[model samples]
Target: MKEYHVTVRRSAPEGGEGYLQEYTVPFPDDEIVSVLNVLEYIYRELDPTLAFFDHAACRQAACGKCMVKVDGAVKLACKEPAHETMLLEPYSTRVVRDLLCES
Candidate 1:
């Protein structure tokens, strides 16, 4: 099994402070995984408090609700590939918590 590093920007709800946290997750190197998948893994297996937004339309990037910053580039989380090392951050709008941006 191969492991990857992900640095996530986290923020508290209601105009609280923000910070960056890092995590190590295992993934199949030969297979392609989306950034949302990695976030799900972290939320499910590592930290339940991790917050993010996703909807049914996220499968095709039609909703635009799962938008986040990957290495300083804004993209739909479901459409961005989870790389060996990624820097994940919420949009510059209003961060509700973790990777969630206020709609």
Candidate 2:
């Protein structure tokens, strides 16, 4: 099966040190899947510890709650298409934990 290699910048709570963690998500080579979809799959099937602001988020790009840095460029996770290899990160240094940051 094809897959997408996603590297996420992770951190714990209370000013914890940050690190980079990579996850491989099963994906179709020609399919246009959103980055948020990969994250959901990881959270549901792989790691429950991964964090992001996806709760009650509007997936239509209308709501900017899923904003994050995709390969160094900030984009809406819900709207941005997934790539074969990508890096996911918070939009700013004020990350609460994982991909979530202070709004």
Candidate 2: C-alpha lDDT: 0.88
Clashing pairs in 2: none
Tens digits of lDDT, candidate 1, 2-75: 78799998875556677789999998777788888888899999999999986854567888788889999998
**lDDT of each prediction vs. the true structure?**
0.85, 0.88
What is the Å distance of residue 35 in model 2 from its true position? 0.5
Candidate 2 least-lDDT 10 residues: 10-19
Which residue runs of candidate 1 sit more than 4 Å off their true CA positions? 12-15
> Per-residue lDDT for 1-103 in model 2, tens only?
6798999998855666788998999976676799999999999999999999895548889878789999999999988998889999999887878899899
Q: Give the poorly placed runs of model 2, Cα more than 4 Å off.
A: none
TM-score of each: 0.88, 0.90
